[model samples]
Target: MNARIEADAAFTDWMQHVQAGMEGTLDAYLPAVTEIPARLHQAMRYTALDGGKRVRPLLVYAAGELFEAPEELLGRAAAAVEMIHVYSLVHDDMPCMDDDALRRGKPTVHVRYDEPTALLVGDALQAQAFAVLSGNVEEQYAARQLKMLHLLAQAAGSTGMCGGQAIDLASVGMTLSLAELEQMHRLKTGALLRAAILLGACSGKHLTVVEQAALEAYSCPISLAFQVVDDILDATADSATLGKTAGKDAADNKPTYVSILGLSESQALAEKLRNDAHKALEQFGNKARRLHELADLIVQRKA
Candidate 1:
C-alpha cells in the first residue's frame, strides 16, 4: 500500500482498538440491567453505551500509551472518565437543563424513560465512576491514584464542570465577552478533557514539569476547540448528521463562539487551536502521533 493509505489504515485501526476497549471496559463496570433499580441501571446503560464517540477514553488510552502505563490501569481510569461524561450528558438533556429529547441519534434518557429515572441515571453513573476508579486502581500507585480521584472530583464538581454549567445557565440570552466565554468553556468542557489527559499520563509515571506544561498546551486549546467545533456543527449540520438536536444553541439562545464571533471567525479560531495543539506536541516527538491525530479529529469530525 502507498504511505498515505497505510497511514489511514493505521489511524482507523487505532481508533477501533481504543473504542472497542473502552466499550468492553465500560461494560464491565456498569451495573447489569438485571440489578435492582433495574430501570435506572438500564437507563444509565442506554445513555452511556449509545453511539457517541468515546473521545475522552481514547484520550486516556493515547496519553497513557505515552507513559507505557499498564493497559489495566488505563482501562479503569478511562471507564471513570467516560461514566462521568455520560452522567453529564444525561443531566444536560433533562427538562431542567438543555431539555433536549435526542442524543447520539436516539431519544435521550429523560425522553425515553421518565425524568426521575434519567435523574437517577446521572447520579448512579457518577457514583459508579468513582467506584470503578477507587475500587480497581492498583495500590502500587496509591498516592498517585488518590490524587487522580481528587482530580476527577474537582473536574466534575463546583470548581469545574458544574461551575461552568451554572455560568452557562445564567448566561442564556445574555451576551458574554470572548474572554468570559472562553473561561466558561475552559471550566465546563476543558477541565474534564484536561483531566482525561492528565489521568492517562499520570497513570504510568510522573511527568516532568516541562512535559506537563506541554500536555496542557495541547489539551487546553483542543478542549476549547472541541466546543467551538461543536458550535459550528450545531449551526451547520442537521440533527441526523449530528445525532442530536442541531441548532439548539440558537433555538435556546445559548451563547456560543459562533454566536459572538461569527461563522468565519469561529472557524478561524478553531484552526488556530488545532495548530496550537500540533505545536505543543513537538516535544513528544513521534510518540504523540496519536495525540496529534486526536487533536485533528476533534476539529475535523462531522458529529
Candidate 2:
C-alpha cells in the first residue's frame, strides 16, 4: 500500500511538472498580446494558456519519451497538438455549435469575446499550429517534422476532427448504434489523440512497422475510453466539477455512451478499453509506464 501511494504521488508530481512546463511552452509559441492584432493575439493567449488537463500534450510527452525523443522536439509537437485542440474547443463553444458559456472553469472564447473574434481565434490558432510544428527545428528533423505536420493536418481536417464534429451535429436527437457512436468519436475525439501519440513517438526516431502497429493498437482503445469517461462525467458530475455545463448531452438530446449503453454499461466499457490499452503496451514493458498511467488517468479522471 505504501509503495502504491508513493507511485501515485510520483505520477501526480510528473503530471504537474508537464502541465506547468506546457504553460511556458505554449506562451512562448503564441503571439504576444502587444502584437499588431492585439485583441486577437490576447484572446489566443487567453484561450491557450493556463487551463484544462493537457492530456493530449501529456500523451505526446509520454509517447515521445518511449523512443527517447529530445525535449525540444517533444515540446514543439505537444504545443502543436494542444493548439489544434484549443482551437477546436473555441469553435465548438460558439453559438453555431455547442453554444456553451463556460470552459476550463471560465467563460469560453466565444463568450469572453465576440463570435467573429472567436472564429478568427480558431482560424489563427490552426494556422499557428502548423507553423510551430514545422518551424525552429534542426535540419536533421526537417523531413520528419514535415510528415508530422501533415499528420496533424489530417487529424484536424474535414476527415478527422472536423468530420467528427459534423457527425456529432447530425447525430443530435438521433438514435445511433453502438458501432455508429464509436465510429463518430473515433474521428471526432480519437483522431487528434492518435495523432498526439504518433507524433510523440515519431519525433524521436524512425519506427519499425511493428512499432507503429503496436502504437496504433494502443491508441485505438484509449481514444474511445477518453470519450466514454467524458460522457460518464457529463452525465454524473456537476457544472462546477466539469468546469463546463454538465448534462449537456442529455440537454442537447445527443447520443453518447451513457445515453445508449446506460451509465453502468458505459463505465464497464471504459474499464474494458482501459484494460485493452494496458495490454497493447505489453511489448514495451516498463518503457510504457507513463502511457499506462495515462490510460488509468483518462478512465478514472473525475472532471
Candidate 3:
C-alpha cells in the first residue's frame, strides 16, 4: 500500500481499538450506580456508544505514540478523552444548548431519550471520565493523571467548552469579526484538543518546554481547522453522508467560517492550518509521520 493509504488504515485500526477500549472502560465504570435508573444509563450509552470519528481519542493515542508510550496505557487515556468528548457532545445537543436534534447520523441524546436524561447522562459521563482515569491507572502515575484530570476539567468546564457555547449562543445571527470567531473556537474546541495532546505527552516521563510549546502551537490551528471543516460539511454534505443533520448551522443562522469567511476562504484557511500543523512537527522529522498524516486527514475528512 501507498504511504497515505497505509496511514489511513492505521488510523482506522487505531480508532477501532480506541472505541473498544472506551466501551470496555465505560462498562466497568458505569456500574457504580446501576441501581438508580435505567433510562439514564440508556441515555448515557445512547450518546457514548454512538459511533463518532473518535478524533480526540485518536489524537491522544497518536501523541502518546510519539513518546513510545505503551498501547495499554494509551488506550486508557484515549478512553478517558473520549468519555469527556461524549459528555460535551451530549450537553451540546441539549435543548438549552445547541438544541441539536441529530448527532452521529441519529437522533441526539435529548431526542432519543429526553432533555433531563440527556442532562444527567452528560453529567455522569463527565464524572465517569475522571473515575476512569483515577480507577485504571497505577499509583505511580497518580500525580500525572491528576494533572491530566485538571486539564480536562478546565477544558470542559465554564471557562472552556461551556464558555464557548455561551458565546456561540450569544452570537447567533450577530455578525462577528474573524478574530472573535477564532477566539470562540479556541475556547470551545481547541482547549480540549490541546488537552488531549498534552495528556498524551504527560503520560511520558516528561515533556520538554519546547515540546510543550510545539504541541500548543500545533493544536490551536488544527482545532480551528476541525471546526472550519465541520462548518463546510454542514453546508455541503447531507445528513446521511455526515451522519448527522446537515445545513443546521445555516438554518439556525449561526456564525460560522462559511458565514464569516465564505466557503472558498474557509477551505483555504483549513489548508493553511493543515500546513501550519505539519510545520509544528518539523523538529520530530520522520518520527512524526503519524501526526503529519493525521493533520492531512483532518483537512480531507468528509465526515
Off by over 4 Å in 1: none
The number of the candidate with the highest TM-score is 2
**Compared to the true structure, candidate 3 yields what TM-score?**
0.92
Using all chains and alpha carbons, the TM-scores for the candidates as numbered come to 0.97, 0.99, 0.92
lDDT by residue for model 2 (1-303), tens: 998898889889999999999999999999998888899999999899999899999999999988989888899999999999999999999999999999999999888889999999999999999889988779999888988899999999999999999999999999999999999999999999999999999899888998899999999999999999999999999999999999999999999999899999999999999999999999999899899999999999999
Ranking according to TM-score, highest score first = 2, 1, 3
Of 1 and 2, the candidate ranking higher by TM-score = 2
lDDT (Cα, tens digit) per residue for candidate 3, span 1-303: 698788779767766876676667656556433566766776777677748877887788778877877655566677777888888888888888778888888898888888888888888888887777776557777787788788878888888887887888899999899999998988888888888888887776678899888888888878999999999999999999998778998999988999888999999999999999999999988877767777887899998
lDDT of 1 at 178: 96
lDDT for each of the candidates? 0.90, 0.95, 0.81
Better-scoring candidate (lDDT), 2 or 3: 2
Return the candidate ranking by lDDT, descending.
2, 1, 3
| Residue runs of model 3 more than 4 Å from their true location after superposition | 1-8, 19-21, 32-35
> Model 2: residues >4 Å from true position, as ranges?
none
